[model samples]
Target: MSGAAALSRPRWSRLLLAGLLVLGLTACASTKGPGSPGQKLDPWESWNRKVFNFNESVDEAVLKPVATAYSEVVPSPVRQGVDNFFGNVGDAWSAVNLFLQGRFKIGVQQTMRFAVNSTLGFAGVLDIASEAGLERHSEDLGKTFGRWGTGTGAYVVWPFFGPSSVRDSFALPFDRLASPALVLEGGNSKAAIIALQTINARANFLRAGEMLDGIALDKYTFIRDAYLTKRRSFEDDDEEDDYEVLTPETPANPQADR
Candidate 1:
């Protein structure tokens, strides 16, 4: 097991331990940037960074190793094919969301095309992404919410999950419950399929570890910046537009009628 994987043991799941870790390591456990909890920086940004570090420590110890092991057990070609298939399905969701944002009808159509081609043309043997009129477009829930005028709120690092903004974090519950893997949850013959998919996701990301390992400075900052930038790229609207918050004082007073 890698050094990070060992430290992610869940025995440290106690709330007290988590709280103490966050408070005590606020200084050392942060990114090198100005917006960290210990730096007296931007309050929201700092809070997010602190949370990110705490979460990263957890993922490094547990998820990374498990994912690494899963990678080793699967055949490379099969893993790649399965990954592409999943991406094809995921593209459908992205397309619908992109259309909802009114930005890139071509993206929506292409994503759906990928889904169809991967399902039909490839005979499940490959993704057939290139064969169909499809292309890759990366985006996630945080960016979608940002485009809709949702504030990023505070940064939080969830154990075993890693960095998330407050707005982005709430979406996790729905995302996990609705993921394709959950399709196997209710049936009796699903155990094998679910296990296989899990392994495939892990096995396919072997290069990810090397990429992560190559980071020279604070891992927290690297992750946070990457996440934020990627999220922003998905948003099609001007996020900085002034939003009107409903206040009681601004409401039409019934007393004015009297």
Candidate 2:
């Protein structure tokens, strides 16, 4: 599992962009009336909110229930094994992105982790690498963009995918290639694997989603803020995965997706 893939808290990263928006909003309120709620950073706030709402609806109606059942019905060890299988698939790509971002030592370590897990770890149903001291690392293209000085662009909520900046969204297509499941020889096709990954990932965060339900006066804004906060904290993050990183394009509601 990725360091960022915790099932709780919606696991944010690369989200400092929105924290800046909060600052902007404060300044805007101090100078202008409260009616002027525009954020210079979030030029697409209106559109983003619409997509965010739609995604939430889908989650409530479909994703959340299915995930709840999966969690309830599946044994913890089995669920963990499933997650491990998927996560090892991601390490291959994360390693590549780590190298791309110029973190050669970490990249090499991750690559070795993948090799060991796929073989000795029984195709990653077990996390042998972590036991051997090679903890998982999340190095997606979004972080890659951040590393090379590409600023996180407008905050846009992808329709079914959740929060992302323009730059990160652009990398989704290329990142899809990194998923080993995409080329799996069995019955699971690329699309099916992606769907399973989404549901499993959503299940991991069920508790966090419920907690957000209790606290968010505006769910959309709350998720947006949490994600943006997580994103911004990317440079200084090193946490355990709640087992969500199914692929490189795993969308941003993110660090969770990692």
Candidate 3:
């Protein structure tokens, strides 16, 4: 394959997957069973599960192995620097979203951290902001919409993008526009950078995902529940805080703690 073709394949594949899932969801909803939980909230669960399976297959075939190799071969310092660079870029956009959500104080802190890290930290290859006691913050347009009282419309499994909701899916375009990958001029370069960032992020979460294996009989439900809980908790919109995910036990705490 040509370089451009190879670079574009995964991006197009994700878009295609999303279109297929959306079409399938419409069909699946009509044939729904009677006694489902939060039917309106997750009416597309059957379709979502199929999309989730495809995403998992893609991860196993490509992303996960690449991420594993990246973690093993790349030096810790280099990986950390790459992570910091991308994180600093994200914080810049997050600051704007935070401000839009009417969080002036945290907005200022996020902006300042980005500034300090970008300049003093060698374009964010070093995290000088953290050393200076300026904490990191994460904000996205999804949270901005939530703050404005938009309900998370339906749970969606976005192919390679994994889990999201209708509200978050709507916010994705704005999020993409703010990404550092968009700053790169060359298409190939942008693709490579995005792939690198994805792998690095996945590598960081490898341990947490591995921990889920022995704890849950249904990994799909476990992941979906965990994801929803985290999303709801972010904006303090969690109507219920009692939900828990199973975790491996330590000798110090034999019983699971909720």
Global lDDT scores for all candidate models: 0.53, 0.69, 0.73
lDDT for each residue of candidate 1 in 1-258, tens digit (9 for 90 to 100): 987777766544344334433442342333344443323212355556667667667556765687787667767776677777666656666666566455675556656675566567573356566666455554455455555544444445665556565556755665444346566556654666555555566556658756876863776666665654444334233232222111122123323534
Q: Residues 75-171, candidate 3, lDDT per residue (tens digit)?
A: 9999999999989989999899889878788888889999999999999999999999988778798777656555455677897888877767877
What TM-score, computed on C-alpha atoms, does each candidate reach?
A: 0.62, 0.73, 0.76
The worst-scoring run of ten residues by lDDT in candidate 2 lies at 241-250
Which candidate has the highest lDDT of all? Answer: 3
Q: Write the per-residue lDDT of candidate 2 for residues 1-258, one digit (tens) a residue.
A: 665566433433335434533443343333322221123235667778888879888988999989999999999899898889889988988888888778787788899999999999999999999999998887687777656555454566887767876656767676766665667777647668777777788878999888989988987666666665555544223432222211222244445434
Error of 3 at 258 (Å): 19
Instruction: Estimate the lDDT of model 3.
Output: 0.73
Candidate that beats the other on lDDT, 1 or 2, i.e. the better one: 2
Which candidate leads in TM-score?
3
- Name every residue pair that clashes in candidate 3: none
Q: What local lDDT does model 2 show for residue 174?
A: 69
